[model samples]
Each structure stands twice: as structure tokens, then as C-alpha cells.
Target: MKKSFLILVVLLISGMMSAQNGGNDMKKFESQLPQEGRGNVRVAYQGKAIDQMIYEFMEEQGIPGMTLAIVQAPYIPRIVGYGVTDIEKGNLAAAKTLWPIGPISQGFTAVAIMQLYEKGKLDLNDPIGKYLKEIPEPWKSISILQLMQHSSGIADYREQKAFDVSANYQPEQLVQMVATLPLAFDAGTDVKQSATNFLLLTSIIEKVAKMPYHDFVKKHQIDYLGLKQTYFGEDIPNVKQEDVTTTANVHQTFKKDKDYINPSETTTGYVEKEGKLVVAPTISPTSLKGFADIWASAENVSHWDIGLAGSVLIEKPENRDIIYKPTKLANGKTVPAMAGWQFYNHKGLMDIKGNVSGHSAFLSRFTDASELVCVTLLANKEGVDLTNLGRKIAAAFDSSKMGTGANDDLLYTYESLFSVDETMSKIEKVLKTMGIPVFAKFDHGKNAEEVGLKLRPNQVIVFGSPKVGTALMQENPSISIELPLKISVWEDKNGSVWASFPQMNLMAAEYDMESNPVIGKMQELLEKIVIKAASQY
Candidate 1:
């Protein structure tokens, strides 16, 4: 039964890709993926596909279930869900299945404040005292903009050790929890994420709009955008089959395979306990108000994001900038991130990520790219870092600018989308394809096992071009020892596979051949080889 259901899920995914990209492109996309994920991925641009990459990543991370939504500006290519959402119930995750989107909810709260600013109901520069009379005088003096920017220095109520996530604390009680604590820094002097800042913003929103915070957001954002899937944390239980809608009515990634069972329930959130996955305790919706309470399907989150990117929600680019742009501190320095978002070196790329109880959520927007791409991943596992994974997925769609080689660390290390053996095999294949001779290969793990010892998966491959090596050797005979460049592939304790090689430029410097132009060519060739082997894009 499991095997039959898995095959059915793959077919539904293929159908979804066909609907989005026509039959030819869908076939080409499938041809590039592994059997398990072939039908579940769509590539908008010409590049190595990432279906297998994502599947392997989820496996390594021990993620029970996840939903990935890829947006290419005005259109979403597809939203694919993987693994079982509820292990005990055996419910497979679907694109339409709701997930609690932790700190990503702050973006919604920020937009709500931005909307009021557009309506002339409130001014960003106005002090919070203008709206809410009950906050401490110090907090009151902080401007509305500071709160939205998270530069108000307000300490987070959630940081208190005694704070109970499962308890229903009123918003006022949450504020009072941190009322007497000193600010992390002087207001607007530095930026820090504080739930208290948004909690107070919610109060001000209620005061200015004369309605409850959730209702105002519903009327202005959710209902306006026609997002049927978004809900407050406490309201998820009431979600009905009729209330649940896929963003495009085209997603069949897991729904058909799931047989439409328990159609309206939120995905079960999980946490690692004693090195095993366990259901996480429920978080109080009231405690997360104005910060991390919203729940939505990955696709709907993409739609709301699309709305935020244009006039559909905030109405003005300047108003949107007030939230997404970096925050300016009192010291005349600007923080790299604002609200819950952190900016990246990639132009116009920013992401918001956090854990809400047992669930982890990530939302990345590459707004400034040649083609705007946004990737959203909602998963059941808590505390999994999705930044690199999200960027790699986006890079699969736009390899030239967003490729993992450029977007990741400065070290010449590539994350492999396969096991150590598979990654080493790919390296050998690339070397053969390039007509570079492989002089040696070693399996450290296998050798250790043969010697009645233990070692994790590790392998090293030595391959190089003699012509290039000879030239470098002529410059310095000592360089010959370093010739026949080798890369080590290993699986870390966490199960992530990586390929590491020496930096050619740094090696050249060591040999006092820094001025050698051929050194640059050798470096580029090595990079090309590793990328082709370890990375999907």
C-alpha cells in the first residue's frame, strides 16, 4: 500500500508540472531528477534540477514533512510537499495543507502597520504614546517606526525562562512580563528581535483601527487578498475542508495521494527529543499575538507575499520599504535586517525564519534579482536552519546569479546532494567528462572498517590536468607535491555531505606564484568540477 501510494503521489506531481510548464518542459524537468522526486520539481530556467537535492536534504535533516513554494515574481511555478505530515496518523503533507509559519507572521503584522500609515490613520514617525496610553513612558517615547523596525530595544517576553508557550497569556500580561526589564539597548540605538515590540504594535493597531488586531488584519490583508488558507494560531482547529483552498487550484503534489484525508488540519509539528522525533507541545495563540501566531499553507504564504510586493497590500513602495529595508540605528549605522528579516549579499534578497513550538518556517524573497524568486519552506521539525537550503533551491532556478557557489560561504566547500560515495562518483564522472585523468581514489570509511575500526562516510578523489600541473610545476617545483588536485567528500555527524578542496589562489600564494595568470584558470576549472559534481545547480 505504501509503495502504491508513493507512486500515485509522483504521478500527481507530474500532472502538476505539466499543468504549469507544458508537457515538454515537464518531461525535461523530470529527466533531470531522481525517481523519488522526478515529478515533484519544476525548474523555470535552464540549470541542473534540484528535486533530488531537496529530497536528500529532507532525509538528512530527519524532517518528517515539508512544503516548498517557489515563486517567480507574478507567478508561482509550483508548491511541492514531501514526507508524511502526521507520522502516527500517516497523513502525507500537501501544498494546501496548513502549517504554522512562525516569525514569518511578523511580516503580516508589519504590513498591517504600514496599511494604517497609508490611510493617514497613523504616522510611522509618531510616538507610540500617541495611540496606546498604558505602555511604560520609556516604551511610549519609542516611535511607531522603531517598533516595526525592531529597533525599539524592547526585551522579548518569550525570552523569559518561566514563560509557558502552552499557557494562554493575554497580550497585556505579556507586555507586563517584560515591563520592568531594562531595554536591550537604547531605543533606535541597535536592532534586536523583541516580541514585545510587535505586541505593543498590535495594541496600537487596535487603538488606531478601533477593532481587534486579528480582525483588522483579516479585513484588510487576508480577506482582501482572498487568502482562504491563512489563520490565527487558535483558529486552525476550526478550519474546514471547504475553507481550505490551494492557491492556484492546480497543486496535486500530495493531496490526491493523501486521498484528501483530514483536509483541513494543520500539519503535525515535531521536535527532536532524546535524538528522536516527537510531537511538540502546542503554543498559545494569545502569547504569539502580533509576532508569530499566523498559520497558512506554503502556497498561500506565497500569494500574500506577492500581494506585499505590489500595491495590492501596502499600496506604496515606500511604505513597504519601511518594513523590508534595513533599520537605521541612532549611531548612524544601519542593521543588516529589520523586523524578522535578514538581508543577504544577493541583491534584494532577504529572508525571515524562526521556530514556533515544534514547527520551523522559512520565507525568502529574492526581490531584486533579474527575475524575482521567492522560496517558502514550512516544516514540522523545529530549529532546522532553512536559509542555505532555501537559497540553494532558489539558485536552482537562477544558477548564474544565485548559484550555491556564489551565495554560500567563502570557503571552497560544496554541499553534496548525495551520499559521500555518490558524491565521489559524481566527481569522478565530471573528471572523466572533462578528460582530466584521475590518478587515485581512497575510501577512508571503508579502509577503517576493513581494519576493524569505525569511521563515518568519507572519501577522497585525486584528479587533475597534467598540462596545467606541469605549467604550475615549472613555476615552482614545490607546487608539484600539491598537483593532481584532490577533493575530500565526507558526511558530517549531522548527515550533511560536503566536498572540500584547497583554494587554488591561496595555494598559488603559498608557492609565491600569485602573479601567475594560469593560476586563475586552474582555480576556475577546479570550481567548475566540484560544482558539477556536488551541486544540482
Candidate 2:
């Protein structure tokens, strides 16, 4: 009876889960990932019993299905899918199940724009009108970066309730919706996670790449990353939710005796009614969804993958390719945010509630460990909870004794200016790294030519500390090995400035020197030393 009912009625799920049904999906992991062997990172797996915990938690709480991909330390990555992708048909969910991973793709859009920048096709500060035949208000003053970063005052498509129609939308229509609304604030003054910003990004990609946004996703990110499991979600056929009120096996757990299975594509926008699925979507043109090109089902789940592959890049120096910043919410609340957690920073959402959708997803490297990466794919879709899943995973790892660090050689890189600093940052992310708590002080000396600098220098600075060095050596004998630090400035072939600080390796290695007490003391002393040394008159 329940089987027939689930097939008839769709489910309106929440973020709650039983955890029990999840099985080995939860628990400690002790596997080896060797990224080099895998063309990215390689590894081996003794695969921990995470599945049992994941299942137990999910079944106990009611999360119907979940997919997990962990790049275990010292080995290759592992992916596991638990529960039903679709509860009605008893379709089993696999790691390959197509779900909407929202705004996190916006950064990819930014990258696409950068690709054009690399081709000398566009400038970062260029106005939107340069490419578009028509520019909206403030378009003349709005730079591309402003739009990419949501510093633009553009309102969002999901801000209004009616825009939640489950049908596909034309890209232009989305633009029209944005245009109808007034700007939330002037570009670059304030920030809101606006779908409108990404709409512009899509429009810009289409204008420059000469392809639709979806196609642009394919040509750049998906193909470049070889991401078989990720997508823009436009090509995945929609599962029309039948009811808005009925509740089925959403994130909530089901009766233990019930032998109900989840499906590959669960209904996201509606709920089950008297065992009948009812899709209660706002009236809108289905064509706006852009899913006319998609027809994915069980027979062809692998055939039509969505094509946006902009997420975390585990490799660094990334050659100045990745750009990110942290900001407090305008509401002025001092509490930690969706963007604050370590290894897992999120800005958008595609959950059961539909709060934020359609922007960026983030997975930052552990700055203190072995440069390991963690993530939460926050989408703009209303009422989805994948980001929550990431947070749970991060907590599990952070609090567990079984956790290990990455063993990449690059973890011991250099720190010069923002360029090299960023590289060193990537290498030391997971090793319990420390921030540049001490600012670098600069002393403008004579030009390199005037001072007899041998090579062509972008700039030069004389940096040292005779006093601090003596004090440190007296305080601790081992501290003498890393003294006498200096920074050199120059421009790369690209003409961008680079700074170099050579002592990161010495400090980083000290933190790993087996003895916990010494490492802690060294960190405390280094923090003070850097601050005192950089103090300027």
C-alpha cells in the first residue's frame, strides 16, 4: 500500500535525517588518496564504515537519499550514494544522481568571464554595454567584477515568491524579471546574493563565448575538469512535484517496518497528498526552464549530465586564477555565518526551503593541515540541504581522532606577496595553518638600479631584525634557525606584482615537528615576532 501511495504522491522533504539508514556513509575514514596517479590526486581505500552511520542517521531522521565524495588522505577519492533517488518508483540513488547544486556555479561564471579576459576579449572593469546591444540602468557604471561579485544592486529572481515556478525559463526572461525590479543598491556599494548577478554572468558568457550559458558551461568548466558527477542542472529532466502539502520520505525518517525505497530524482518543489504526488508550482512558461534539451531518466542517467564544473581547485599557485573574499552580512549580526566554517564555506543554497539559489559553492583548503579541501555546494534553489550535509561532514572530521592530513609536497611552498602568499596558503591549508597575523612592513629604499640591485626589480625593500633575532635565540635555542626574513618584490611575465617571504617553510615545518608543546609555543612566539617586526614609525 505504501509503495503504491509513494508512487502516487510526491514528497516534500526537509533537512532532518535518521542517520541509521545511512550505514557506512557516516563514521571515520582511513584511506589513502594519491592525487598524482589519478591525473588529479591518487590514493588507496580501506574505506571506513561511514555508510552505516550515514544510513542510521538518515533513516532515523528521514533524509531520503544522499551522495558523498571524500578525497581520503594518502589515497584516491571515494564516492558513495545512499538511499533512493526517487521514493515512488523505488529508484535507487547513486553518487551519479543529478541534483541541483546552485549558485556555487557563479564563480565558474566569473572564471568564464576571466577566460575572455585572458583572450583579450574583455576587461575586468569593462561596462556591460560594451558587449550587449542594450544596457539596463546602472549598466554603464557597473563593471564586470561588480556584477560577478554581487556588489551590483541588482535584485534576485527568487526574492519574489512567484518566481519559484518549477518550469524551465528562458535566459532572456530571467533578465527581464531582474530588469522589472529596481536595483537593491548601487553597484559596488552593498552586496546581496542575487540571481540577477549570475543572470548577467550567463548573459555575458553568451555574448562573449557566442554560446548559450549551458553550452558555455560545457565548453569551459565541465570538459576542462572531467567532472562526471557535476552539472548545471538545466539538462536534468525535472520531476514535477505533485503536492505542496503532503509529506513523504523527505529528510524525515519513515516507519521502521515500512520497506519503502528512495528514488534517483526525488520531488523537490511539492509534497505527497494522500499518497499522491502533487506539484504546486506557480504559473509560468515551462520553456523558461531551458530543460527542453534534457530527457534524462533511469535508462540514460549517465547520458545527459549538467555542465558546470566550477568548484574547489585542490592545486595551488593556481597561478593567480582563483579569487575570493569574506564579508559580514549587512544585518550586522556578529554570529558565525554560512561562510564562516573551516574547510567548508558556503554562500548559496538549493535546499528544501529555497532561501538562496543559483550562485556559488565553496570548498576551502585546510590552512593548518596538509592543504586538504572541504566543501558545501550552496545553491539558490529554495529548501535544499546539501550545504548542511557538508557542515556535518566537516564537524565529523574536525572532531574525530581518525582524521589525517594530506601529504602533498607543495604543502611546503613559498610566500612572497599576494601571489606567492596565495600559493603557500593552498599548500598549508589542512596542516592547521595560521593566517598572516603580522603585516609586512615596507621600507622604500633607492631604486634597484640606484642601490646596485643586480636584476630588473619591480621594487625593493630592506627588511631584517637584529633585536628580535637576539631575543628569540635567547628565549629558545631552536628559534635561531628561522630568523632573518626578508621580502623581495617583482613582476611576473603577466605584469602582475608578486611578493616573496621565504620563512613560511621553516615555520610550517616547525608546526609539524612531532612535539605538540613545542609547536604551540613556536606559533605563539612567531605571531608576536611577526607583529613586532612589521611595526612601522
Candidate 3:
């Protein structure tokens, strides 16, 4: 009877302790909540209830694993993980679960370049030939700044499928392969996102730093920022199989019924022979160094973001600003997007996103001088639209921003009442009526079909008046990149045809050009053209 009474007392104590722990957890969550109107933390995101919304989103999106980190200025970041890392093993995702960050690695590479710049090791205007000889003609003249801005005009190697999944090449070989390709345009005349640009930048970093690319990143970015969970390359020391999140299985043969089998599950074979499953070939991360292949947890990425905001890594605040600042062309017009980052003047935010074979990641940093909020998301699945997803989460804290809520500079979109072809035809007709010259009309869908590929209805009509365009270009010749203006008519997923173009006024602001009479006239003319094309017959 006495022993039974002792056991009862112990059970009562345990129950009381569990309740206290729960209260403490609640208190911690409450402390993290934005105070009333200060952060404008939306009603739905209040308290600890945001978890339920995230779970529902994961379920709706079919995301097997996801890690998210939200940071508000000087406060500690709130990092959380949702869903399972491995479907077969049933391993739960966690904040520290590592996931490949894909091309987001370029941001880190950019930082390393800036660090070299800060130390006076290299000049932004220095030609590529200065760092390494035998770079060939046009590329030799390309400046370091142009490479960072993707204005070097080097053709992208990925476009040619130059490297296979299993192929590995040394840095020099990668540069040589790119050299064999012709320039897209003259250096600094236009901007295009090219992995080749980063490859060149990586080579420059290696030469300037006199160290291996991965080692430099490890010491300067990963270790310096105290990102314990971050690492370069595919392997992380001392990490177990279950500790890392696997990329979503993108192969068609890997699917079981309608659902995808976990790539991490060794028991399930992905091979197909006469409709039977067999052992699948192991897929490795791309052997390309510096431009891609960095892996980190959501929590570590947030730490890097925080370090970027603070003086931890780049000591000078101005140096950090240079990393995201738009590239000013020779004629004074600037590209809104920078090296690895994109600037959104409407909302005062800078963000970067990357997608590789099986992973998608997004990092957004709000640049409001008074307030600091950063959102980092890492997911195992490709094609998840991490930009929109990141923006949706960012809106919970501040919803006043506009323009897609992401860093994409597509400032205008107007749905058309007609089909995509009809809309393009109408736009062309309007241009002809206005006496504007149609420089080119590209049928992208038709081109894809010619290549035995399927694409939704899409076309671009390039038209501009020489009188107006010349006036703008005379003001800033760099504005020519935006000239020969093009309007894209495409069909969205829901079968709605639409016309989209960048806002002229926003472009004016981005280039820092004074609003002239011609600017206003061009804006008015474009709006009328779009309206006429999108109007009901």
C-alpha cells in the first residue's frame, strides 16, 4: 500500500512538470510574436498558429520536406521544419537537415569576390585577361564587374548541355569549354543569367585568392559566418544518412503508382525493365565547382543572412551594399538585377532564388533601413515556385509591399480577352497602326514544337518607334538594352491568355533617368497598345 502511494506521488510530479514545460514553450512562442502594429504580423500568423498553415501548404504542394527560417532584425530567428525527410524511413525534417542550395551558391561566391575587392586584391574594372592569360579575344576584354552583372555576354554552357550528369571537369577545362562558344552580345551591352559568368568569376576568385574555390568559401563564408550546418560539396563530415534531406525524385521511372518513392530509400529500386522495377542508378550532384553545389540547412542560411545584415562577415556596410547594388552601365542606365541578387525598388527588398535538378531554394532580405526581416526557405522538390512561396510567408510580417511580392522585375501583367496568338496579332496590328517598327516577332512555342518539345502558347513581339527610342537612348545609350521593346503574350496554367511587360516608369526609376516628356509619352503609348490588344473584340 505504501509503495503504491509513492508511485502515485511520482506520477503527479511528472504530470506537473510536463504542464510547466508546455507553458514555457508557449511563452517562448509568444515572445517571438510581433508586437501589434509594429511588424504588422497578420492576424492569421499570430501566436503559434502559423505552423498549421505551413503544414497545410506542404500537403497541398506535395512537398516531402521543407525547412523555413524567418528573422526579424535583432531578435533571434524562428526556424522550423515541416513534413518528412524520407518517406520510407519516416525521418522527420528538422531545422538542421542539410539540403542542396543549388545556384544560390552564387551569392556566396559573389560575397567572396567582394571580400577580395575589399582587400584591394582586384579591381572591378580589371579585364579578365589581367587575372588569367589565354582567355581569348572578346572574353579577355570582359571586366570583373561585367561578369558579376552577367553582362559579360558569354554564352551559357548549360544551354548546349555541355556537361552530363556524371561528367566532371576541372575549373580550367570548364573555362575552355565556355571559350569555345561565341559571345551572346558585346560585353556590357546586355545582361543574361549565365552559369558561365559565375564559372569565370569562380576562376578569378581562385586566382586572386590563391586558394581552392571550395576552401576559400569554407573559410570565408561557412566558417567565418559560424554556419555550423553549412558545407561546400556533396559530403558533410560526420553527418548521418537520416540527418540530411534528400532531393525529390524527379525521374519518371522512380514513381510508384502516382506517388514518388523516396530516392533515399535503398530498398526501392528505380530501374525499369519490361515494366518491372530494378536497381536505379545513383545520381550525384553536378561536378561544377563554385557556381553550384553548396549545401546548408535553412537555419544556417538564415545565419548567413543575419551575418550579411550585421558586420560579421563583410565589415563595411557599404561593401555589403555593393553586393546587391544594380550594375550601372557605361551610359548611366542600370540593370535592376545584380550578380546573384535582384533588387525590388517598389518594396525595397533584395532576394535570390535557385533551382537545380531536384532542389529549390529562396532567400529574401528586406532592405528597409529601419526594419530588417529575412526569409529563407529550402525544399527538396523542384518546380515548387519557392519565390512566390517565400513571398507569401514574408507577407505575414509586412504586407504593404507590391509587385509579385518577389524580386522578379516583371512589373506589369495584363490578361488578354483573346487567345495568345490573337493577342500577339492584335499587339502587332496596334504597333503597325502607331507607325512603330516591328524589329522582330519570335514564335517561341513554334520553335519548341520544331524541336519536338511541347510548350504552352507563347510569343514575343518586339516593336519600338525610332523617334522615341532614339530620344531615350540619346539621354542614356545604356537604355538601348530596354529598347526595341518587347511584349510577351502567353497562356498561363489555367488556360488564360495574358500580356506582360515591365513597367516603363519603374524602368525609368531603376535607370535613374529624369522623367522627360518622351518618357511620359512612351509610357502612355505602351499602355494604350496593351489596352487595345487586351480589349474585347
Candidate 4:
């Protein structure tokens, strides 16, 4: 389950490709487009078929049931559902079939906090102690923003392997589990993705709103925003039998298959387990609320997205910015991930994803200066790559800038006054500073000499952190080709030396890795090392 949550975090921060050629085309299309409704817009696209793409992806990923909503802002959302909700009963998943959203609950929690802020009930900078007086000493100093951004130094409850997922834990019990442990880092100094953050935020919401967290979210975000099919529970509220999708462990069935026929070859239907169709085990919502445990149809989730993008849920539009804006530390360094949602600044996208025992979800909102578009996907299986699949769907609606071509060149270059050899030495020193092992060093100029050909001074230093590189490769093994990071130092004809290395973000894009805290840390380290290597001082 912890691994599933980690996967969710990774999916949440993976930024989409920016629109390169679509601006003018999109503008022209928008001019001719008809308005759909209050929070909906019609978007035009010339990309490949979206429905077929989703069908193929679901088939390939063994996703039993999925519901998707594509919202072209200021227009009615296009919602679709596929496959059977129940394997044995043959019930079809539909627009109102509720699926557990897992950690996407945090996004709602963040919105609730911001709603309170809009009403002047709380300040984001206020310490948790302000609302929850029982917060421990060091934790008392941690601000609400810190908790929202996962920079409060609070230990993650999931990190405690012994903690019972099967056993229902109350909000206070969850807090107490982590409250006694020493912080992972100084508050506000670093960001670590932790459900503990949202758990505390839930408590804060209750204290500030003078009601249960669920009540606050229901009154302010769901009912107020007109999310008719959304609810905070393991089961779909007021939905009987055929209305809600049955969550299944497709991954488990896939693993157990002996013949292992490709899912695409078989018709979409029940997931058979040893000649018997299997249904997902029921779990209680009370066990996962605040951190996980929110259920909604894709359409309802899209409605929530529309509400957020339009700032209709929060009275103060500016307060809504808090959801996607990164938290800045006292030292002025900004955490790349936002307080409530993971933001890709370059692409102007906000993302939220969740993966629990039997469900996975992804929601992305693209907001450029001119338009806002949202794509939401909810699935009743664990292994589907919702982030990539959602991007594919978004591209179908706006193909102007959606392919996997490296959006930006990976290479980051810095000029230095020192000669090529000196820069190479500096590169090695910088790598050493971070304990990244130097795997190999190649002097291209020397190789040229051996080949009896003259060449300019050029050297490449290969170094990497196995812990970091291995983690990346574990996610996508193909990334091994880009692993064991390298920095090249060369002297130009003008005698100016330059050091260059691949930016981790570009590498991540190339390898299809998500932008999680580990990747963010790797990027920070690479930037620091490259700059230090090229610095004259």
C-alpha cells in the first residue's frame, strides 16, 4: 500500500509537455467554439483517436473499470466510462459509478483550508498549535503551509511498516503515531511527500470550521460546487448495486495467470481468478478518511476541478492560488511541489493522483493564460499509468503540444574561466561533495590522439548516486541508458571552458519518470554540482 502511495506521488508531479504550436491554432478554434455551460468550454484538437487510445491503454494495463472526464474549460465536460463494474454481475461502469480517489483527498483538504482562509478564519502561516493545542514542541512551530507542503518535518505514518492498514485508525491516532517521532528534517527546510500532512490538515479543518472534516468539505466543496456524484466515503453515497463500480485487484489476477494471454486479445469483461471471478474486498472509509478515502465519479471529479479552476468554491479567487503555488522556505528556496496540488510551472498544469489497495486516480488541469482544461481518470485497478493515459486524453483534445519529444534540451551548460582540465577536476570534486561515485572518466581529446587525429580539449566525467539512479531505473528500467549521470568539460577555440550536464527534468521526461521528491532532490543536486563545477571561485 505504501508502494502504491509512492506511485501516486510520482504520478502527481509528472508535468505534461507544453504547447508549442497550439497557441494560435487553439485561439482560432476557441473563437469559433460554442460555450457549453458555466464551468465548461469546447476545445478543438486534430490528434489521433482518444477513445481507441484509452481502450488500448486500459487493455494493456489490465484496468478492469475506468471512468474519464475531459473538460474544455467554460464548456460541458465530456465524460465516458468503459468495462464492467462488477466481474460476476456484468454491471457496466458509468458516469455516476463512484471510485475511491485515494490521496486525491488531499487536494480537497487543501481546498477546504483555503476556503477557511478566504473566510478569514485562518492564516496559512499560522502554526498548527494555533488550532490544535496538543501539538508537540517542535511540531507546534510548524506552520499550516509547512504541513500542506509536506515540509513540516513530520514523520510519515506509512513509513512505519508496523502501522496497521487493516486496522481502522482515527485521525487523532494517526497524528499521535507520528507526533512522537523526531522530524525527518528541520521544518520548512525540505519537502517530503507525507499523508501525515493532510491528516493534520483534516484536524485543522475541523478545528477551524467547528465541524467534522467530512462535513466541511461536503458543505463547502461538494454540495456548494454542485458535485452531485461526489462523496467522502469508501462506498458511493446513495448509490445502489449497479451504480457504483466494484474495485478489483487486476494486478493480482494478472500475476496469477499461467497462460498469461494479453488483455487486448480477450474481450473486456470479468477478471477470472482460477476459473472464479473475483471482486475487490470491501474496506471502510473511516479507516482512510483525511489521507485517502474519497469517492466520486469522473464527471463529479471534473466538476470539482472546474470549481477549483474557476475559483467558484473559494470566495476569494486569490486564495485559490494557494492550491497550486509552491511553498517558499524562510531561506527563500521554493519547493517545486505545491501545498495542495503538484504544479508543473513550465506547462501551467496542476496534478493530483492517488493509488490505494484497489483503486487509482489521476486529475490534471492545464491553465495557460488563455484557457483552462481538465482531464480526470479514475480506475478500479492498481497498475494503470493514469498520468500518461490522462496526458494522452488531453492531447486528443489539444494535440498542439503533447508528444514525447524532449520539450527542452536536457543539457545544462555553464561557462568557466578555468581550462577544460580544471573544469573537469572541479566536476569530479563537486560530484564527490555529494558522495556520488565516479564510475568512469573519458578524455575524448586523448582518444582522438590515440586515433592519430587532433581534437580540442574535451573530457567527460561519469558519476552517479546508486540510490538515486537505481530508484529511477526501478520506476522505468529503460532510463538506465541515461543513468550514471555525466558532465562534459570542453575548451572552446576562444579558450573559454564550459561544463555541461543533462537536467534531471528533461531526463525524467525522456525516461517517463515522474517528478517526485526524489527526482526533485536529484535535480537540485545536479544543478548545484554543475554550477559549483563551473564557478570560478
Clashing pairs in 1: none
For each candidate in turn, the TM-score is 0.67, 0.48, 0.62, 0.64
lDDT of 2: 0.41
lDDT of 4 by residue, 361-476 (tens): 78877777544667888877753437656755665554444322222234555544356887678778877776778999999999999999998999998888788788777888
What's the true lDDT of residue 117 in model 4? 86
**What are the per-model numbers of colliding residue pairs?**
0, 128, 0, 5
Model 4: weakest 10-residue lDDT segment is 261-270
Q: Which candidate comes out best when scored by TM-score?
A: 1
Which of candidates 3 and 4 reaches a greater TM-score?
Answer: 4
- Tell me the TM-score of model 4: 0.64
Better of 1 and 2 by lDDT: 1
**Considering TM-score, which of the candidate structures 1 and 3 is the better prediction for this target?**
1
* Candidate 3 per-residue C-alpha lDDT over 158-259 given as tens digits, one digit per residue, 9 for 90 to 100: 666566534666656666667777888888877778887888888899999999777888898888767767876555444434322344433443344332
lDDT by residue (tens digit), candidate 2, 337-412: 1111211122221111122222112232332242343333222123333432343443344422112122212221
Best by lDDT: 1
Q: lDDT for model 3, please.
A: 0.69
Candidate 3 vs. truth: CA RMSD?
A: 17.2
Clashing pairs in 4: 40-74, 40-75, 41-73, 41-74, 41-75
Assess candidate 1 and give its lDDT.
0.79
